[model samples]
Target: MYKLCHQQQVDNACGFYAGHHMLVIAGSKNIRKPEDIVLSTGPLDDWALAGLRESLAKFIMSEVISSKGEFHHPTATY
Candidate 1:
């Protein structure tokens, strides 16, 4: 999705990437059934696409910060 978004020059590539990542994570975690995830995120015209993308980005970011050993740069020596 990142590559596609970049290649297509979609506005806010990070949003596209974050949204795609959320959909994948949701499918794996069973937050939503795989079929629903596939259908919702697969089509550009799907009514739920915008909502799913926006919410997933927020949800994923929240999870990232809340998870144990939260993300940090490996180069940070402090």
Candidate 2:
């Protein structure tokens, strides 16, 4: 099993990647508010926002995986 270090475990991007690929959920509490996300354009309804977040999360996860950790959170963008 791939294990994340403390820093990775606490990161939202890393948590998302682990959840999808490893079936390991971590750092749910670390999810940032929409307003806190610089990539967010504006307010979105619950469902739309959820979809956007999910897409972004998946994109980040894919990037990290394909790049072998070269692409990661705070750097991986949609």
Candidate 3:
């Protein structure tokens, strides 16, 4: 997962990677407030959140295919 996200240069790769691949949904209990005022607008709106969900689903599908031992590095295509 780290390799996958690192290849894409994603920030907070660990959490985002897990979110993309995990079958069971995970939530954070830490709930720290955002330091940036831009984030103070609250959670993402429905449309934006839906787009994220779609991306996660696509990632999971790709992982499932790669897990069949078809690719040496599953993230190589990215």
Per-model TM-score versus the true fold: 0.28, 0.30, 0.33
lDDT of 1 by residue, 1-78 (tens): 212222323555445555655666565766454444432233344444576667766765654544433564445454
Off by over 4 Å in 3: 1-40, 66-78
Supply the global lDDT for candidate 3.
0.43
Per-residue lDDT over 1-78 for candidate 3, one digit per residue giving the tens place of the 0 to 100 score: 112212333455435434433422233234353221122123334575466678866766665545654333656564
Candidate order (TM-score) = 3, 2, 1
How good is model 2 by TM-score? 0.30
Clashing pairs in 1: none
Minimum summed lDDT over a 10-residue window in model 3 is located at 34-43
Q: What's the CA error at residue 44 for candidate 1, in Å?
A: 2.8
Higher-lDDT candidate of 2 and 3: 2
Please identify model 2 stretches exceeding 4 Å from their true place: 1-43, 67-78
Which candidate, 1 or 2, has the higher lDDT? 1
Name the candidate that leads on lDDT.
1
